[model samples]
Target: MHISDQEILAMMAIPQQREEAFKLLVDKFSQRLYWHLRKMVVIHEDADDLLQNTFVKIWNNLDKFRGDSSLFTWLYRIATNEALNHLNKKRTELLNSFDDLENVMSGRLDEDPLFSGDEIQKRLQKAILSLPDKQRLVFNMKYFDNLKYEEMADILNTSVGALKASYFHAVKKIEALIDNELF
Candidate 1:
């Protein structure tokens, strides 16, 4: 049985139904959010940890959600922030440059048994990893998740024009990288 976001929110507003509402939220969004985090983090374990942290924050701040945007957008914003923060923390802790971290993540992707992508997909992911964080986020959301620019704007709190420009640059860079490697 499919439940709508409004139904979930309505249930959440009632004290008696809050737990059930949360369960529904988790069921509805977990896999999608996990993949979103996994694409960003590149390691299954790290993505899982970040996913857990995202849920914890969601549970803590559920009441603070004012429904200014769709539930999906709000949830995505939380997950995206968590992933970005986790990456930033890792970068800070390693005392390495962003490129160094990207190289490390690329190595992890190669070694990751859980990564089931074929060679081309792996190459694409490496190209994606080469992007700056914001561009990576924009590319992942638009290319993989198929979110609209307006939704991405809401989730990332940036203008649609900025997102379009970022995606354009990301695609150009990826195309250059892929063309160089493939040909």
Candidate 2:
């Protein structure tokens, strides 16, 4: 069945239809969600885990969805939170320093078989890793995903102005880092 978000919501209300509707929802969004998480986490395994966690959260909490935002927005918000939380836990477990966090992520990116980008792309990824987690999130959403500031603000629960500032700073930092490495 060609299921829209509204149709899914309607199906979710009926007990028997809920599972089928949720399955369709997963089929529809799993790829987009996977790529978004992949960009944030870099490692395929970590991204897969986070994507599963995001879907599990969605399945468990689907009833609580109030339609305050688009279903896609809600899903992205959940996925973003999962990625950030996973990174935070990893950061705390590995090292007490942000510099260490950068090295860890960069190292993972290097070792990832899926990362087939050229040298400049790899360096840009490393530069992105150097940003604070929040700024990195903003940069990924804005630059890689090409999401608008207003949409990002909704996902990140920040003002558009704040997201813009974060994006601006992230761009500047990434540019400087890449330039320094080149010279």
Candidate 3:
């Protein structure tokens, strides 16, 4: 969203005074951040948890947030770390197919409502979740999030070239997976 680091710094300057900036921050980038976490964890409840944790960490450590990167980048980095940690802690995995997910997601979707998709989304998500962690992260950030490689590089703490390569490999993997099933 291009919120400057200075703006974030100003908001983060006082721990007690950070509440005033809530609307500004939420107005700026909640949905994108939520989905960014969702694409990692694949459940509405988990996404919500991770999103809350990401913001909480940001709020708590905003003063520690260096302005060397853009505010969005900093938020993204936090989001990524929080999501990854949650996944690691839960050691939880998404169900492998439609039947289980459909039943489980019925109630969950009603509660949190991340996305509404028919068949295409299910297949797309299956393809995405099938990817290895780094590839999935690279693909989600580059493809779905439409983030620039340089910015993603900073958020992922990887070189831009490597992020580009990872994205390329991810696309190839998804294409091959889809093709093998359909074509």
Candidate 4:
């Protein structure tokens, strides 16, 4: 049985149905959210850990969800924040430059057993890893997840025009990287 976001929110509002509602939410969104995190973090274990953290934040802040955005947008916002926070924290812990961090992430991708992409796919991912974090998020959301620019604007709290620009640049950069590597 598919429950609408409104129905989930209504269930969450009732004390008796809250646990069941939360469970339904996890069941519905977990895989989507996990892939979103995995794209950003590049390692399965880190993405899993961050997914757990995202849900924990969601559970704690359920009541704070004002319906200003759709439940999908709100959930994505929370998950995106968690992924960005995890990446930022990891970057700081490494005490290296972003370029160095990108190298490390590329190395992790090389070693990640969970990653089963072919040579071209690995090359594409390596190009993605070279992007600035926000640009990477924009590219992943648009290119991989197939999210609309408006939805990305809502989730990232940015303008649709800005997202379009970021995505354009990300694509250009990726294309350049791939072309350079191939030739």
Candidate 5:
């Protein structure tokens, strides 16, 4: 018989039983969460820093966590916000507006650290990087993360219907880019 996550979480709510539970969560989610951050920032060091920061936040916020959504949804919300905030701070450092930053990233795939991979996947990654930020987030959550629309809604703080529409548009844009070999 399997113990559900919520059951484990309940046990972990007691400070004495929390270490193993927290370790389990860290082990379970670290890589997937890290990759999520990597997809956005495209810098290995930055992703590593943000990944650690995300877990640190989880550790601090665990007690405050409302259990209103799944654990992954809560964590993804933190991770995504961390990634976006990192980008925004960096953008400000460069004295660029968010829109200006988007314009630059539109053509930046060839140089992004996170885009290092084999031919096909790298091509796909570049095309993904060309998308608007929300669309990229939606695509990553839906396609790579395999998150449901409901989970995405929680993480993004968007309605499920909006996520579906964003996903549809992202797929369409990717198809168009692929057809043109613009990746």
Candidate 6:
């Protein structure tokens, strides 16, 4: 069953109803957020950590939430930021070379039992990994999650035109990578 945004907002407004409201929110959005993080981080454990962090942030900040954007978009913005921050931290700590970084992420993907994709999907994932962070985010949100450009723009705080260009470049780069067997 779907809860209306108005219902959620009403529930959140009362001190007594806040916990249940947040619980409903978590139940509704957690899996979507998890997959989004997993696609970017390529490791289930790391995704779990990022998901927890995202929820904690949400819980702490819900009272400050304005109704300017849909709750889904607001939640997505938080999740996206948490994932990006985690990735940036890992990159700084683990950097040796670009190829080395690719190998590490590829190894994680290969080791993930949760990943059931065949050869081509794996190759596509590797190609995706080779993209810059923003481009990879744009590609995943557009291609995998099927988010609308306006929705993505609200979450990414980027213009729709910029997101379109990013996705286009990301697709072209992935095609080239696949053709050359770079991943």
In terms of TM-score, which candidate is strongest?
Answer: 4
For candidate 6, write residues 26-116 as lDDT tens digits. 9899999999999889989999999999999999999999899999999989999998898788888777666466678988888889889
Q: After superposition, how far is residue 115 of candidate 4 from its true place, in Å?
A: 0.8
Q: For residues 41-120, what per-residue lDDT tens digits would candidate 2 score against the true structure?
A: 88999999999999999999999999999999999999999999998898888775656777988998888889989989
Model 3 C-alpha lDDT per residue in residues 25-137, reported as the tens digit of each score: 86677898998988887787788888888878876776676578888888888888887776555443454444443344434443445567765666677787767677889
The estimated TM-scores of all candidates read: 0.96, 0.95, 0.80, 0.97, 0.82, 0.94
User: Which of candidates 3 and 5 is the stronger one according to TM-score?
Assistant: 5
Query: Could you tell me which residue pairs clash in candidate 5?
Result: none
lDDT of 5 by residue, 20-105 (tens): 78887888789889989987877678889999999999998889988888887888889999998987687787684446565555
Clashes of each: 0, 0, 0, 0, 0, 0
Clashes in model 2: which pairs?
Answer: none
| Candidate 5 runs further than 4 Å off | 1-3, 96-116
Better of 1 and 2 by TM-score: 1
Instruction: Return whichever of 4 and 6 wins on lDDT.
Output: 4
Superposed model 6: Cα runs more than 4 Å off:
96-100
Task: List runs of model 1 lying over 4 Å from the truth.
Answer: 96-99
Q: Model 5 lDDT vs. the true structure? A: 0.82
Write the number of the candidate with greater lDDT, choosing between 3 and 4: 4
User: Candidate 4: which stretches are off by over 4 Å?
Assistant: 96-99
Clashes of 5: 0
Query: Of 4 and 5, which scores higher on TM-score?
Result: 4
Task: Give candidate 3's error at residue 3 in angstroms.
Answer: 7.6
